[model samples]
Target: MASQLNSGSDLGFEADLFKAADKLRGNLEPSEYKHVALGLIFLKYISEAFSAHYKKLGEEEYADQEDPEEYLAANVFWVPPEARWEHLQANAKRPQINFTDVNTGKERVGDIGNLIDNAMDSIERANAAVLKDVLPKEYGRPQLDKTMLGELIDLFSKVGMHSADGKSKDLLGRAYEYFISQFAGAEGRRGGEFFTPRSVVQTIVEMLEPHHGRVYDPACGSGGMFVQSERFIENHQGRRSDIAIYGQERNHTTWKLCKMNLAVRGIDADIKWNNEGSFLSDAFPTLKFDYAMANPPFNISDWWQPQLEGDVRWKYGQPPAGNANFAWLQHIIHHLAPRGTAGVVLANGSMSSQQSGEGDIRKAMIEGDVVDCMVALPGQLFYSTQIPACLWFLARDKSANGHRDRRGEILFIDARNLGHMVDRTRREFSTSDIATIANIYHCWRAKPDAGLGAYQDIPGFCKSATLEEVRKHGHVLTPGRYVGAEDAEDDGVPFAERFAALTATLEDQFNESDRLTALIREKLSMVRYDV
Candidate 1:
């Protein structure tokens, strides 16, 4: 898969550019440095894009002087000379004046922070909506060192980030994503609210197989889910234009990140921003999506449940004002079309929580036959919270596959033991790990009457539990309790001999415990005398 990616020598290769830039981060926080590095990358991308069109205008073949419409017609933003990359790189080493005319006279540039602010303003004026109020304007603070800022600019300039050809490459896009991931790692608990791990997003896309139509993310964070979905279609030999993406993000800063993220990937998505969130003011109220994917904030407390307590969208049961787990579930469920399927990540509590009517809501949804599968994911799979997470797959119509009209059965998979550690602190499923999980789901969901592969109750893995069986288990969807333990070993040795061996093992353990206690006391005495 890595080999299939765009394989070129990667011109202007400065692999350690970000590392060098980091060295200049004297007292600046990564949260602050994030905007600085990403802002420059955004500027570089726009400049390269502008230069590409500017050259064609200069050439005789495409010469159309005095016609800005020529460039606008091709979806290119018009950039002024001062905001262009060449001009910035030329003056990168030189100090420049900076001022804001807020009912006052022009002021001199006393710091690099002020210079960066003016640069962002110049870019915004050149191409209005392209960057309007998007750039982080807090960098001109006293905390950010002037020498460090200069060094970062020089480091970024060394790369061919300003060239027209660089626009065609996703080097900047990849770099931006890389930096976001690094920031997520740095800022552990708060990171999950903004970024979704690429592997988790890929798993959802792989399972849903969103070939075409609208893809939606209700709690889209930095737009990773939608971006991965587009890549999924492209990887499957489908045109990127085959899918239209839609999303809604509650946080304004995250919404801005989502916009920038989608723009960097060259994927057009109509992402909406509102502080009220999807529960209160659903931006896509009337919209039904063919595919839905999200990692909604886990166990969201204070989700304005009182305002939406009697809302019509709650078809299953009213989610408690204390927790929005079931509310997010029904919202995604309501958005699915007749044949639509959705993959959502939620807290482990949602799988079996009976607290505050959550269990009843889950039971109602189960009896209605929308829940297709539930996977218990390993802990530490998220950056935001350490709590265990699970993946929920919901389908609108199970009869489409002719699987005995399976409106009563739900597949439960316990994959808490599946992923491997990518680092000491985080775990991510590999491509094979993803395929293993997706293939299992596809296998179990195959039509029983269609003569395809049949589903089975694997003792240590998956089990297709019926509605009656689910009721017998009191609707607790934990897979381990249902799948049960594997068969006991049957050796040729007699049961009497085995019992004798077990008794001897127990006796040995008791004797060994006594010897270890004496060794501990000797070490304690030596340490006490030395003290």
Candidate 2:
């Protein structure tokens, strides 16, 4: 649950820092304590950013340091002196302030908790448009340990090291993301409600390569998908402005976490939340995105309603009320632009289950040719469930839209044997493993110059099968059905040549069957006359 996190080169911190912070958590549940800890981290980042920008402006000739416009232009939150990190930390152990209750309208002596609460209020007031109702203001609650709150402030002081490294302000976000992962592990099943394993999100983002245009996630959880997508653009040296983010989370507290998570990283997104969820209440009903990436809850049974039976998003068919695997898939597919592509995570049963018309829906999608590729992942790759899962890559266009014309072929990758164990119960795909899987996909999509090399099947690892082949196997898209055993002999020959040989063998079998049927009828007629 802890890591040796070093920001830039000159500034670094050990895992002990997080352990110390966790110790201060004391009797508070992670669900409640996350806001307290994360809020302070957010406060630290903005305060430091504003103070640095403020000082730099003051040193410049004819510059106004007090103008909020200057800080807004620089993408830094303008923190009032009373709300600054130094001001809060200086008064962490004690406070001297007259506080008025917003609801009660009465004045009272304030403690350190009330001081911090007022600080959050001032920040939100100054940046009304962006930070409105976004920060947690429950620090004054009696259950919070005032002493422990002061200790947490001390623990997060190490976060200041990030500002010294001269890196992007997003380093704090990395630290924030790591802490969320730890909390997810500690909370077990309940944690899965808001968090997805990092490797899984990384692998999807790498494969999709969502560099530009509108990016979306309907079941966004804690907004990790959006964060990773933005990071992808940053890593590839692309323009961040070229990417616009949109998402929707159903859980209220989880949605708040998503907002703060983005705010710390300085990522602007349109993330919506509603109790009815994405299924019953569509937030972006008409907005088609260029790239959609999501890891929705696995095999949810209560997602359907009577109203959903006739919904237009169910283009393939109406999903049975008992399961919503296809519902999420169809919703994503419906929102894709003409050339948009998406990567979705779902339970392994989605590959071959015929129950409740699921098989018919699979056939419809295959016949329609929206399914671009399927990947079977190793078990324990998720923190939420251990049923095993697969990634479904859907594309609205399979023609040569910058890539080769792949209208009737689907790439199958059996990565079930790839990832290594990261802990006693969970497995993760290493950077090398992710690259191996993603690069093969790119190669299959484009020609030699487009990817690492011209696409070639790796026998046990990947295979590109035609529509006819899928039909032969009853439209089961499991990678295991196409990407043969890993132990299968490799002759260093290309897949097309082997496919041709297999086709000839299939034709011979059909011819022999016809001849035997005629012989049997002739023999049966002879016996009947004798009898």
Candidate 3:
């Protein structure tokens, strides 16, 4: 991991690179361009790994050990002869000639376009499961002009991107991830299709505190949850190696992105891919996870729920087929270990919607003492939808952490007003904001505080509500309704004096407006006389 994030400040490297690539975007949208950029990064990564192994083979000490096995032993995919970075760079200036290459046939090797397809085919054969659908072989399509292909290759070559050191710096990885976020932001609602806000991931990590355990994401998008879990371990002075990661992604392209993202961070994760999501396939049927987190698509309607009518995971109640919110909840509940805790993001309706037997599921979970904490998140936190989101913390046992018995009580945090806008359209919780929310949960869950902030509850901020109180509210989990309105300031001024001062200011403003009107009239009369 690079100690300093080059994407943060004065380093215009990523910005410049993205701008140049965007120029070449031409007729392709950001979503399509994402595949193009990620493929290049993956190509660069494998090529560098191959080059590194090849250099070692050239050394006399390891000359006998220089085989594909040597590279595979180190988790490096074998880059075939024609797919090497040097070979591609040599022909970057001319991306149209059908030069001969022994491996890819006497086909076009001079064109950067053909090289991309050849590389994709080679990688697909090398690692079928991980890279089969990840590489961009369609660059040779009629849409991409030869001149533009050459320009892109030239730009990438100039960035010192061909070397192992450059790829290993983790710079390219961050840049590529940054591009994902940028595209997500650019695409608006569709952005949520593949990306989750980083701050939300951090907040979940901070609260769940997945120090050492199996971390899983059922609807893993680009593996942000897994990456954040690794980051949490490192931040807590714990080794990421102590934790195991497992994930399942329905989208093939997104799954590839997740694999590449994890690979870039050097994190080993077992990611399963299938058209049917966890709902239909149930990848890890018998395995229980220590910590599970996910940001599932909000209000998913076409989840193929009819096929899973009597699923065993529905311990609470059968979720409404029209909405998959409760279904995802039950899935995580079923997958949790005896000592497991999970934090998930869902559409705000899950908190209070009583439609279609959802209220029954909520009541059952509450009665079972599984629902831990509920948080109301602010709007615009996601790129995919403007609908508000909330967080649900589910714990197998409240007594696991030696905290007070919170079975009868649930922590409701009204953080709907928290977070700052990152841009005009999207808002993300800052580091302090994340810490503040996490600290509140930690302090409340501690042996003593469990749900108090400082001394008194900040109005409209947070509150600890008992099961009876929750029942009084009819199982609705919206925090604002329970937390009440925020506190108002006491100016300490007398009512009469304050009223007089306000009246005087209004009178002065009125007099000034009248004088301006008279001056305008005099100016008009003078103009008429002159005419």
Candidate 4:
């Protein structure tokens, strides 16, 4: 999303805005400051949408502008009078006074923090279905600075979230996305708990081409997958209503972030949250999705393995008690529609590890013809951990999707050498890199007349391996073993000539070593005589 805001040599307006906002965060941790700033941004987006709709309804012949359903019908969250950005901004610098809470009747001082908290509560009450328990109402906390809260609201008031022609809405969406990424980076390892790298999410969306269907993510962190998928559809000139999104996240805070993220983009999704998580409490249990994408926590040791000992989702095999890699794989597989295709990000070990029957589960999935493709990713692509990762493409019926029939073949792409370093400790896939990888998969899967061009194996890069070839390697799915090393360039020297030169060089080095040894011994002997 930050990529969209750049204009050649300039960092663009959103980047500049985020920098200014970060500067106002004096003595506040990014973790806490993010909630404050993002809450305001979310409020701004919905209020603008409501105001636009309200204006239209007022111009109508006999429309009721005050009715909440009028805004709800247009897919706009109804921002009550007290919760509107203008109201909050108007009272931003209000002096402290005795205030009574309507719900609790608790007498409190009317400061900027209390006013902001009340505004958040009013918004939630007006639109409970979408905003219930999602908006952060912690601005009144004693630790937060009231003056800074008012200043932050004033800062966001300058952001033009809506325009008469409605072109600025897209800009606002991009800015929201950029802010999410910036916050994720600032939060470091904790950030990865709620955000996936934008490039990685883009690559997954490009590969799946989830153009129109039910898309789902079991561990939907901040709903990045849904955002990217929406972008893909919009970029292709498709209608947003064509796709339905479903997601589940264990973390309540991240779930609220996901809700706000999707709401700001005006993408309606059924994102559920609970403490039990997707593993133990399977939300959306009987539903199957057409496209599923997830970056589940890698190598998790406590995924309620004992509680789910005989779960039906473990059709491939029971995952080891000490690891949940196979469990995640099977859960995704179980939730896939008959024609569903999924792209999963997992630790590289999932591609070849044999520990605790993971290899057998992999073997079963491969033999079942569900494993479509495996791509080894470059390192430093994640903010959470530095563990090398890979993408596992699973398709329930690859042969039926107007694609070439290759049921027994799996595509292995060794992309460990692909992405470029973005910083000292991070790497990202360039536009060309993402296109190159996605195009390879498309070509390999497209039918002859599909216009994606013919697929061919490139040494040390990609290979279409047969099941027999896979079995020979003990069902190990690491791409390197199958793709082989890239061929080296010839230096115009004959093999015999090179061998002769190497041996000659070795002989001269040996002779030099012998002379040095004799010189050292003679020196030692002279020193002994002196003693």
Candidate 5:
């Protein structure tokens, strides 16, 4: 645990706080230290929320501040006396804590780590129904650095989380989200296991616009889809309670992170976790959601099993044993209501893959008129792999859901050129970019641009292609194949004159290069060698 001090950045939003925390991480790996930092942040968040509620309860003559139900009724976790942030901060620097056992008439000794662990335990015990075993309690391990841990606790205590910028910016939630991304950046592909980039998630949420319905994510990562959906609703002045959240995550650690991430934002979602995962052990087997949005692991080859050969979820066809791309598509399709719609993020290969019946499955979906729209995402947008990805928009009943009847036509947007580089290695969709893409999809769904409206397909950018056209191409949905070349601006210059001028310039450049080389050799020959 001495290495807990050795743990782990600077992002723009909460870069200063993260920089301070990184300095304190001494040598701890980002993966391990993230739990430590996040666990403390969760502890502090719930403690502070409870403290504020407890203060108000103290003024009520008949109120019993110790009553757990009082906090539970207000949607606040009941932090036990010893588990409070104030109590933890008071003992942060202590070398040892002495506890007198009243029942056993004995004394107990523990360092700050033990105290912190006990605090998490007590809090979990008090809120078992909601937060059972979600908090990390490994700080008590002797291998962790006590001094560094104390400094972290002290550091967090000095900072204001709720209203840092003289505004209710949900800075605590921002910090948690920011830390998840920072840790994801540090962990590389492993981090992608627990997170989807915010802009990518937002793009899906804004396009799908999961307004007032049951939203499901089979590969929900850290609940980013749900969070963004809720944010979208709020941003549009929609009621939060109008929507319900359901998700399933296979990895236990990522599930815990998702739980904490949602908790920080005060979102109540039914997120399930099983080692067998969404594919093998369908979590919401009998449930159909109105909206299903997800970013599944791209092109996983080892997810196939003999038991899935006859699985009912594979309605279109049995997915190949080597790739689960079609399996995920079918699973999401299986879970949609008659009028349900889904937006899925997959490897770009899904758009044009011809391997192992993936092409046949795509063709079947196309013929069934379920494929609605596809958008090609820009490269380098993910922290995980550089495999370019695309979005698959499907609707169960596209013609009858108050949408324009165009069952045979699928819209394709070539957005591989969208988004700007945020740093040297990463690119992100700006707000304008998200809005533009979302608007295009919305306009197309509302009505086809008869060359006079908002949805006109620009050459090499977007197109609404017919089923017959797709059939001619063997169901390869890569936008580039359909969108055509982007229209180029013209600077009128005659072919012969321009060719002659360009040739003369090239000849002159070649002659200048030869002259410079000969001149350099002559000068070297004239120079005197001393040794």
Candidate 6:
């Protein structure tokens, strides 16, 4: 296990950058400042990308340097002249601002905030298809301090955001990820809504290995799942173009964040947003995906369950109207392709709860042979809630795909003791912890020739249990039930010698007690005689 938290002075450039940006946050709450800071970072990223492409187009005789289509064709967001980073940086120190609205021909006078707001607008208008309403345009709000905003812009400007030809796209992307994580930590519960902790996301991506085909997340908060899946492909030397991305986010602000988060990483996704959410709206309604991963709002009580009766996604069983835990599970299952696999994060109760037919649904899913594995994770891994959670891994077709036929088997991993505390309140899986868990799954699912080692049951850590064993436990999916207690270490002393020593100690204690009793009786008799 390893710790990810660092002191202000120890965390290198990103940490120092975050601290500097936060100082300028003065009166704004983290919730508000999050948009302010992240919006600028996103703006800087696109501008750099556009500028790098613009320089190349300028050198080519046949290319139109100013053509928006040229940048769009290369999957780059076109930044208009007024919206470029260089222009913004140059104007950061302006004492007074004056600009004419291109659409209305109206003169606007304010400060740097107005300039940034306009820049955000221009970028959106220029790349309407990809960025239509994604960028935040509220920098001109009255509560924001102009001086701090200017300084913040200047601070970001000093950072070398681009290489000569934009080869450092990932550098900015990584920084953006770090910022999102930090903001989540700052915002606490609300932050967890938009961001899944990186370690947890990495574990899922590594286990699923979404190398190709379509990947989807119905509750795609800030698109962390999609980002990690793309990174997984790149890390493993797989072509990112092999997989298409699809997602839906109900929160309007979070939806915008997801779009920018993906765009910064050069990932094209069909991420949709609707107030009705995935349940009522069903954004990717008719599409089946090769892989689906999500960390939906846990145990949501007001998921509009009264309106979801007889919903087509409830193939296993109807989820209780009060809690949407089972609803999320069935929804993910519904969207899985014929041979698709899925990994989902849910409350621990979902694994063993018998309330409102949830247990029955688990039974049906188990009997159907769709449940592949269940991992019981440690607590304190989330910024959202303190509730312990588990990972549910499902496979649509287990007996096919050149893997061993695992129809009646399920792997249970009790990882509640694996991770180390990163801080006083938070815990995260280290690189080694993630690799250990993923290796178990891969070995269990892979063929012998795949080069992953053969899977073996480690007592109290992992166990491959038969369906009958699951049924014997009354359909409870808690990993501790199947994996059993870990074996205790053996001391050098033999059992006979240990027992003899214990008896000797007990005899000495008995003898001492009898001597004390006799002395007390003698003292009492002497007192009686004297009386």
Clashes of 6: 0
Assess each prediction's global lDDT (C-alpha) against the native.
Answer: 0.75, 0.84, 0.78, 0.86, 0.84, 0.87
Candidate achieving the largest lDDT = 6
Tell how far residue 136 is off in model 2, in angstroms.
1.6
Please report the TM-score between candidate 6 and the true structure: 0.88
* TM-score, per-candidate, Cα-based: 0.82, 0.87, 0.83, 0.88, 0.86, 0.88
| Model 5 RMSD vs true structure | 9.7
lDDT of 3 by residue, 1-531 (tens): 121222343355666777777798777787777777767766765676677667767775645443667766666777777677777777767636565543545654346776677777776776674565666677777776767666666666555433334334455655776777888887777766878888998999999989997998999989989888887887789997799999999988788788888876667889998999999998999999999999988888888556798889999999988899999999999999997899999887888778899999999999898999988888888889878788999999886455666778788888867899878988989889998888878777776544444423566788888899999978878777678843111132333677889999999999999999999999988874434
* 5 against 6, candidate with superior lDDT: 6
lDDT of 4 by residue, 370-417 (tens): 999998888889888788888999999978675788799999998878
lDDT of residue 167 for candidate 5 = 34
Task: Pick out the ten consecutive residues of candidate 4 with the lowest summed lDDT.
Answer: 486-495
Best by TM-score: 6
Better TM-score candidate (4, 5): 4
Off by over 4 Å in 3: 1-12, 49-60, 63-66, 97-110, 160-169, 402-404, 448-456, 486-531
Question: Which stretches in model 6 have alpha-carbon errors above 4 Å?
Answer: 1-11, 486-531
Cα error of candidate 1 at position 367, Å:
0.4
In model 6, what are the clashing residue pairs, if there are any?
none
Which ranges of candidate 2 are over 4 A from the true structure? Answer: 1-7, 10-14, 95-107, 486-531
Residue 246 of model 3, lDDT score: 92
Q: Least accurate stretch of 10 residues (summed lDDT) in model 2?
A: 486-495
